[model samples]
Target: MIKRKWSILFLLGLSFASVCQAGGDIDALYSRIAQKDIQALNELKALAKDNNAQALAELGFIYEYGVSVSVDIPQAIKYYEQACDLDGDYGCFNAAYFYEYGIGTQKDITQAKTLAKQLREKINLSNINLDKKVSER
Candidate 1:
């Protein structure tokens, strides 16, 4: 049991480190994009291809607002769904909003509600896990 707990903690630590790394990468990429660094988009795409949840959500935002590319709602929705599937909160929220308002896709209140509920649960679970970890520590 002690070994299992240690393993779980190790995994959690790794996940936290990766999340920090991803956030740092995203910030750097955003800065580069702002400086008109043409390779930034390619790097973001590569990160998305690697199944980085944040990268996928960033792509969704870029496509949704036509930041550097043409506005493509369908593509944005596609990226959002991909990120949502990976448990990205931003992606889930935006996807839910789009579904709720019939922006770019057919209005589906049921799907929106489901997404909202799932997101809430995820947030709750994360909080619970954090509390548990702190107590254990």
Candidate 2:
């Protein structure tokens, strides 16, 4: 358990570092997203196609909240899972949330637990405590 925890932390830390390195691009993307820019959305889609973790997470957010498109929970989950697979902490947390509540997919506590565990050791942006949520379930 301890070894797994350390590894998750290590992986998330690496992801966080890369995000920090690209902080300017992320901010610009969010700025465009906030303005409902279709170009930015397209850029995100392009980035997601390359398996960009941050872009995948952003696309998940856009789909989940209907920023410029209709709400598509399943699509959001798909993007979030992709980001999570790349060790994006935010993606892991959000995907875990959906799994925990069965929002887009069937309720799967085990899957939720697995996803949440990936974020438990990281300082994530979501601020939604997946560990607490999973424990309460």
The total number of steric clashes, by the backbone 3 Å criterion, in model 1 comes to 0
| lDDT per residue as tens, model 2, 41-132 | 88778888988888899889989999878999999999999999987888998999999899989998999998887886565436666666
TM-score of each: 0.75, 0.73
Q: Which ten residues in a row have the lowest lDDT in candidate 1?
A: 128-137
Quote the positional error of residue 100 for candidate 2 in Å.
Answer: 0.4
Tens-digit lDDT string for candidate 1 (52-116): 98999999998898877789998998999898888888888788788777899998777777666
Can you tell me which runs of candidate 1 are displaced by over 4 Å? Answer: 1-15, 125-137
lDDT of 1 at 133: 27
lDDT of each: 0.81, 0.86
